[model samples]
Target: MSDSGLPDGFADLDPFVADWALPTRAQRYEARLSKPYDDLVSFYDAVAPRAEEAIAYLNGLDINDLPDDAEKLLQLLYSMILVSYAVNVFKQNRIPDSGAAFFDMVAEPAV
Candidate 1:
């Protein structure tokens, strides 16, 4: 594994791990809102192409007990989901015309 803790095949994503591999929905959401649209686009463009491959790689593992590197990769994927909305629909960091609007997730599936 690389110093970023991502698996070998995903080393290219290491540069994004610190900022994008957020461990929770709230964190990812905050990150999405904090970054500029271009940043989101950069992340989306880099990771979207490898998404399928990442999913397939992760599918063989036990979701509840992913290894450290794998867990980071999973978090990165989660962030990608958040970025998709900005890149594909909203075209901005936050939701359009939804100022100061947010919700707390009372429950979320374990990663």
Candidate 2:
């Protein structure tokens, strides 16, 4: 844990992402494409639930008042929160029958 007592899981994400071979966006996307269900479940298990604490810790801070580097780190931590939400709460893996693939934003609103 850091001096602030945050979980090492929250304090450092690089090791976690690297451990899963998903340290980069492209690698994560590939994991989703190649192992959609496994990747989502794995990521959720590793990062979610635990991420709530991290999110809460970050939320408790005054982001706007933080130093530039600290703010950037906080932003990255928030990204982890978002990813956990998507994978765990949303359970987004593949389209109903479209096979395994990464989520693509809808180009336009569904009519």
Candidate 3:
């Protein structure tokens, strides 16, 4: 693992696009997984901050005019949103009505 807590290939990723490199929690928990469990946890911790930055950037883009590359990233951000829901709402018992939100917020077209 590198100083960022992520393994080598992951530490240098563009923070906004790092989601493509992160393994979902489900993957880490898979029965047949080969990687060390500790490595998975470390990677998750390292990627969490980058994922937040990515989500924020994606939230500011207009969905209709998004670039092709960004479209994939947008989908990845949505997956992160689902993970947020699981952690905050389900595991932490947070009320959806109180703080629920989505990352994608398309800007209004100029008049």
Candidate 4:
């Protein structure tokens, strides 16, 4: 019901939609690198707790026919997954000691 189109109870995540609801793996990866460590942590903190609830909500829907709002939510979840590594493991935006490293995703699954 929010302007971001995310389902109810997820409006708290509205502030992140423009940045985190990226539509592609490559974009999401780049987003992870572009954000500061603190920003990444903030995103993780907000989404981590709701991840399970989001999954369960999505599970009942038909993947082939998700609504626009649902799709955005899914994208946010994907971004969360990408951010988790930075927040939970790397503890930085980019991989430690791997300066300027990048992954060229030649192919990605159809959305």
Candidate 5:
């Protein structure tokens, strides 16, 4: 097990530890990338198609099905980690909300 660089209270985020420790820009430029990082990138690419499937699965859930504690996972999947990778790395700006209340908490979108 690696030191996650996170505090103890945020245990639910442990699953994301491997993805989070990916090489920085300098490291990638220097070709000091680890095999695990490359594997993770490949894994995410392989699973890219499943994002929509996951979204559809989420849509299938009823309000009652989601326990109140799901907020942490929601934020982890949305605001914290994913947007950076989607927008910056994958070059996608528009996030598909699929007529859901996706941007409710966000401010106005810039033109």
Candidate 6:
């Protein structure tokens, strides 16, 4: 956790574009592309479901229960969240309106 009481995962994930990747992915279907951030909340809402699923999947997980791949998954998820935040700030300009929804959900996919 940071100075705030948020758990490590909470700090690392992108509140925006949480599960918004699917549509954003589809919106750019067939195009060679960079990530989008224009409406941070929009993307977050779009992808929120994926995050929720991820959380539900991860809930109650114990370190011993994790597979060998668990560590890698954690790193990947953190990296993706950072990337999503950066994409939003530099490319999308600000968090989309749906950022709140993104936060409401607890899990997200790796980029």
Query: Which numbered prediction scores highest in TM-score against the true structure?
Result: 1
For each candidate in turn, the TM-score is 0.95, 0.43, 0.35, 0.93, 0.31, 0.33
> Which lDDT tens digits does candidate 4 get at residues 67-88?
9899999999999998999999
Residue 2 in candidate 4, Cα distance off native in Å = 1.7
lDDT tens per residue, model 2, 75-109: 44443544554465556743445555446544522
- Evaluated with lDDT, which candidate comes out highest? 4
Which parts of model 2 are misplaced by more than 4 Å? 1-14, 18-31, 34-36, 64-92, 98-111
**Per-residue C-alpha lDDT of model 3 across residues 1-111, encoded as one tens digit per residue:** 344333233334435243333334343123113434343344344446667665666567786686544454544444445344434445432334556542332452231
Q: Candidate 3: misplaced stretches above 4 Å? A: 1-11, 14-34, 64-68, 71-111
Indicate the TM-score of model 4: 0.93
Assess candidate 6 and give its TM-score to the true structure. Answer: 0.33
> In candidate 2, which residue pairs clash?
none
lDDT of 6 by residue, 7-90 (tens): 445434434322322323323221112444444445444444355645554565775565433333343334345445545554
Summing lDDT over every window of 10 consecutive residues in candidate 4, give the lowest-scoring window.
94-103
User: What residue pairs are clashing in model 5?
Assistant: none
Better of 2 and 3 by lDDT: 2
Given candidate 6, what's the lDDT at residue 4? 30
Candidate 5, 1-111: lDDT as tens digits: 123443334454556544432333332222212334354454345334444544455466564465333332332334323334543464443334444433332332221
Residue 12 displacement in candidate 1 (angstroms) = 0.9
